[model samples]
Target chain A: SQQGEEDPQALSIQEGENATMNCSYKTSINNLQWYRQNSGRGLVHLILIRSNEREKHSGRLRVTLDTSKKSSSLLITASRAADTASYFCASTLNYGGSQGNLIFGKGTKLSVKP
Target chain B: GAGVSQSPSNKVTEKGKDVELRCDPISGHTALYWYRQSLGQGLEFLIYFQGNSAPDKSGLPSDRFSAERTGGSVSTLTIQRTQQEDSAVYLCASSLGPSGVGTQYFGPGTRLTVL
Candidate 1:
């Protein structure tokens, strides 16, 4: 059961353009985090937004969370070829007592053409 | 300062054979997790270990899949009677605390191929 479902299964844009990816999940969540994977290997943590927080920013990455809608979005500004990779959104349930496994979305394949 | 590490970057075994994969988490981290990713698919949660407490094995696909974390630092995932469908990338991650409270660092992952 995938908790987070990312929209726009794939996207393509120019290097200087901006790319936006959206994730929608069911049920309440404690927090939502985004990760980036290159070459289908290890994933790198990008940013995380807690249920109490509405928005957060790290470098060129901006993340927003809307509990009411159970959705989150990731915006990458000035996209570069280096940013071309698969992006995934994961969410942790709000349950108690150490049940902290993350349910991940299928991911969005972003292609930044230079 | 070292990140999570997994052994045998890649593994290839015949069907019905048993295989073992290892994960060495960062020093002092208390939480470890295992995930499986098929081709062009999202990761599937396998298991989780937090300190000395019992592991959360609810996500394991079958009885053939089992894992253990020794001394709260190193862990191993074992698969008995491997099937072709079991071939996928096995990723290990560790965090300072539970995923709800901390970010998890991932390993390079082992590419397992069951022929």
Candidate 2:
């Protein structure tokens, strides 16, 4: 079963604008990772934020985790048309085992219009 | 240095037949995973194997789905009695370990279309 769900099932944004997608999980987690899928292809690793950490940044990607609220958000600053893709948040069971192959959410589809 | 690879890229089979999808994880990676993605759908976990042994088969949706990894390198997902609903993109991923923080590199995926 998937443990997380993303809001705004689909979104349309203009190029160079900021895009924010939110994810809420049903359980605690050791860490949360974000992934991007282009068209109907495979996934690309974007960023991962650990529970011990509140925020993480990589290139144009920014991830914030609010463990207190059991939610996380991914922000793509200065988005490009290439950033148009389906974004997913994944996490483990968060209780006993290691964070293995994640349980993924339905994902948020962002379409960046040039 | 190579990422995960899955083949034959795409497959179209009639219902009630059998099909096999293969995945070759990055060399030396000890963890392999198989996920199914239906059209406009989230990834559904199918199986997980570590070091050529699967400790979790609970993710498989049905008994018709089975997978195996040999030498902790290449893994194959075999679907018996393929159904129309089984038509989807089968994705494979691998990582060095289940260590809560490593990245799982994914393959291009095999798009299966059942007729």
Candidate 3:
């Protein structure tokens, strides 16, 4: 299973606070991506970090990949109430089998209180 | 055009009924995929299609499940004599290429409720 496992299945935080989510995977990957899903909606791509790249940033989203530990972390700084949504980390493998199918984690549901 | 689109957004069926779910991928995308997610569970890989080649159906759980891509643009996933365990959200995704390592755009999934 190339599935990335995300910890802290659920989180609640005050608006404007920083939120951190961690993901762990079993196999080597070509790149790792973070996505956000509004309730009952399609997934929105957040950020992607490649194997050689240790960290990446897009807007307020920061993604850090540690291949040595086979883990990655997503940090949302100055999160707002609109940032409340489920977040998932997915990875593309070095091996090819599931064509364009991203192995997604169970996801972490976040609730930001205004 | 627009992003990936899926039809029959919600489906409710009885046991032993056959169901077909359709997916219309982004225009010009060459890769399409199917996945099933049970309540609170992670996404489960079902099948993958790349251009006109044979699909990689290794993730399909049983022979009862099958899918096909027509014209490399649209796809239909057919489940035969479905069982109660088949209840889940069926998601479809499409990518610009056969690079499974690339980011994909997902469609709003069809939620299956098997009674």
Best TM-score among the predictions, by candidate number: 1
Residue A18, candidate 2: Cα error in Å is: 0.6
Clashing residue pairs for model 3: A100-B100
Encode model 1's per-residue lDDT on B1-115: one tens digit a residue. Answer: 8999999799999999999999999999898989989975669988888875545677889999989988888999999999999999999998898655788889999999999
Q: In terms of TM-score, which candidate is stronger, 2 or 3?
A: 2
The residue ranges of model 1 lying beyond 4 angstroms of the native Cα positions read none
Interface RMSD of 1: 1.5
For candidate 2, give the docking quality class from DockQ.
Answer: medium
Of candidate 2 chain A, the 10-residue stretch with the lowest lDDT total is: A92-101
Q: What share of the true interface contacts does candidate 3 keep?
A: 0.73
Model 1's chain A TM-score stands at: 0.97
Relative to the true structure, candidate 3 has a C-alpha RMSD (angstroms) of 1.5
Q: How many residue pairs clash in each candidate?
A: 0, 0, 1
Which candidate do you rate higher for lDDT, 1 or 2? 1
lDDT of 3 by residue, B1-115 (tens): 6999997899999999999999999999898888887775668778888875545677898999999998989899999999999998898988887867667888988989889
True-contact fraction per candidate equals 0.69, 0.67, 0.73
